[model samples]
Target chain A: MTPTIPILRVRGHLLVSVQGELGDDVVEQFQNDVLSAIERDRGRDGGLLVDISGLEVVDTYVARVLADTAAMARLMGRHTVVCGMRPEVAATLVQMGYMLDGVETALDVDDGLDRLGLPR
Target chain B: MDPSLTEVLQFDEHQLRTRLAFFRIGEEELDRLAAMRPLMEEATAQIVSLFYEHLLSQPETRDFLDDPVLVDRLQAKQTAYFLQLFEGRVDLAYVENRFRVGAAHERLGVPPRWYIGAFDRYLGLVRERLIGRGVAGAELVADLAAVERIMHFDAALAIDAYVAGHLATHARNQAALRELASPVIRVHDRVLLLPLVGTIDSFRAQQVMESALLGVSEEQARVLILDIAGVAVVDTQVADHLLKTTAALRLLGAKTILTGISPQVARTIVELGVDLKTLHTRNKLSDGLELALSLVGREITDKERGS
Candidate 1:
């Protein structure tokens, strides 16, 4: 059986839990899914929470896609909060010159939810 | 015409002419010029090696030396430059030639600062080498000083040309960046507001990331708001910038909020098919402001509130 994308709903916020390798292909699909959710909830007052706990390595391309996704959500009138980014992954993103110009990042899902003004 | 008088007069004339010509010629002149040749060659070679060694030791200059072809070309030019020093006459023509080479480097975008350090070290090496060769007399010192004087004159001209070219390039870049304003701003005591405006290309995106990182650290900001309201479009590239920024801000231990998304930007986000299901973003600047305030444990009334 093909592995399914793990998406959990918390307080009306879509939480996409990513794990393992976040390749360009996987990240592309992930970006599409997040965009779909934002569109579904357009004109709404909620946000999405992304948990990237399982990611070990993020290449320049994947890192860029993740940032772009957050920006796109903001345009959709929804907030994009990413949580559970590994320390190593974060370092790689920094070294690769990834710009998070206008994205929100939190330590964990709880912190991310809180930043989005969502209840635990 | 008189036998005794003619002989005496002819003899006197030849003697006077010979003595006058003799005064014009010096016996030690040829020997002195010849003796300086070997010393000049030795000093030139030593200076070249020392220059290369100093350049290789520097990280910035080392890259320029990585290519074997380029290294060889540079070494050859440097050797030629040294040899030209002792070519007997130090005239305006020689100075002009050196100046032309230096100006060429300036046009080629070579910085003058590196040349100063390299030239200084080269002189020190020449002194050390000369000292080892048992050449410590006042005459030797004078010769070395002359060489240094010529080099300094050439170096100054090169640096001036380089500075002019550098300023021109800087002016152009400044003009471009000025339109974008400062990518970063300090809003609140512990908060930084980086309102990313215009279409952010990859290079500009990197600048934004670096600016944000540096601004946060230098400003000791606890909260960072990436205000994107003025951002006209949000394609995949834009989305990628947001993700990278978010990831980076989290690492820096600063809370980040993405604010300002217009309706047109929203449609682009959907059309591009990017997933931002798990990121914090706000439709308006005020929404982000509220979130930033909460992070700092501050609340605002209706005046600062936005729907």
Candidate 2:
């Protein structure tokens, strides 16, 4: 089983970069970790930034989990932003029929942070 | 049909053969074929040589037999083909062989017209030889009729092969064109540009939406400029497709600016009752770019002002 993606707190936002392959266990762990991190950092309620640039492939199931994670985070008062999807992965995910609806996205961690952390 | 391409095209060979029954090959033709075997064995080598001589001489068919080595190889195959053809050995294997002949020619860029023309040459020679052997008027006519039926069957099978090849090529081209149509040009760090051209259909509309949403997220674009200046027509579905793409991008925290909407397109959108209310529309890419720059907190100033 691959290790759980690391969740870091940078200036109040929860930052997670998904690298390599995520096993079934790893994705389940990721979901639990992000949810708990939001709960742990309650006072600030800073956004969540999930960067997937390290991934070469992302299947529909994984894409669904990412979207679900963002939606779950949003209900907890923390804005969840997904960022850094590779072009190949994006094309594949689109082909796989994942729209990633309502999940905030940005080019990288910096862009994602601004999109989520700052007001529009 | 090559089974793989046939599977994709849903081509039915059994049905095709049933349809080709109009050419009329039967037991009587098979009997005539058996009668011709001894003579065909003697004639096969010479006829194969003459057939290729005619093909290689023609500028059109010559290209199909360009390599001298390949021509030599084909002459041997054609010799064996004719010998078996007259021996009444057209079982399942022979039918399959006939299909392969057509497909092979189609792949090598040999037109069916040439194959039919080759039959004309073969028939003319066969008439001369049968007459030389003392097979007279009515029997010769019957023999010729049987031969004609078989050649027609061969020609029809070859046409099926050609059609299948073209269908496969057309499908491949469409897939390539879709990939080519959606190009995401990233102009700035936080800005992405999409210039949509040509007629938009529901299929391509879905393509555009998927492409734009994914591009916006992939590039982390804060602003997207969708320029539709070259698009000839827009209807309700197209308007809906564009709106869905914009909405998806907006939720991804990207602002979308629809630029290059011709006066005609804008009227079509409004008349069709697609709300362009939420979108920031622009007449030109320059205006769209300026707005995108401002959205990303940048500005372009004249050199004279600083000087």
lDDT of 1 by residue, B1-307 (tens): 3243223223344543353244332233323333556776866766786688889989988876788888888888888776664564443445445555665677755667777878788777766765676767886665465546545655754564466556767989876885465467777877789998777777667667767766775776668899887766777777667667765766655767878877776676666665566456788888888888877788777675583
Pairs clashing within candidate 2: A106-B220, A107-B220
Q: List native contact recovery per candidate, as a fraction of 1.
A: 0.20, 0.22
What does DockQ give for each predicted structure?
A: 0.10, 0.16
- Candidate 2 backbone overlaps, count: 2
lDDT values, one for every candidate:
0.68, 0.77
| Sliding window of 10 residues with minimal summed lDDT for model 1 chain A | A1-10
Model 1, span A1-120: residue lDDT tens: 335567667787878888877765567788888788667765556778877767777677876787788788778777788777665566566766664545667666776777788533
TM-scores of the models, in the order given: 0.37, 0.65
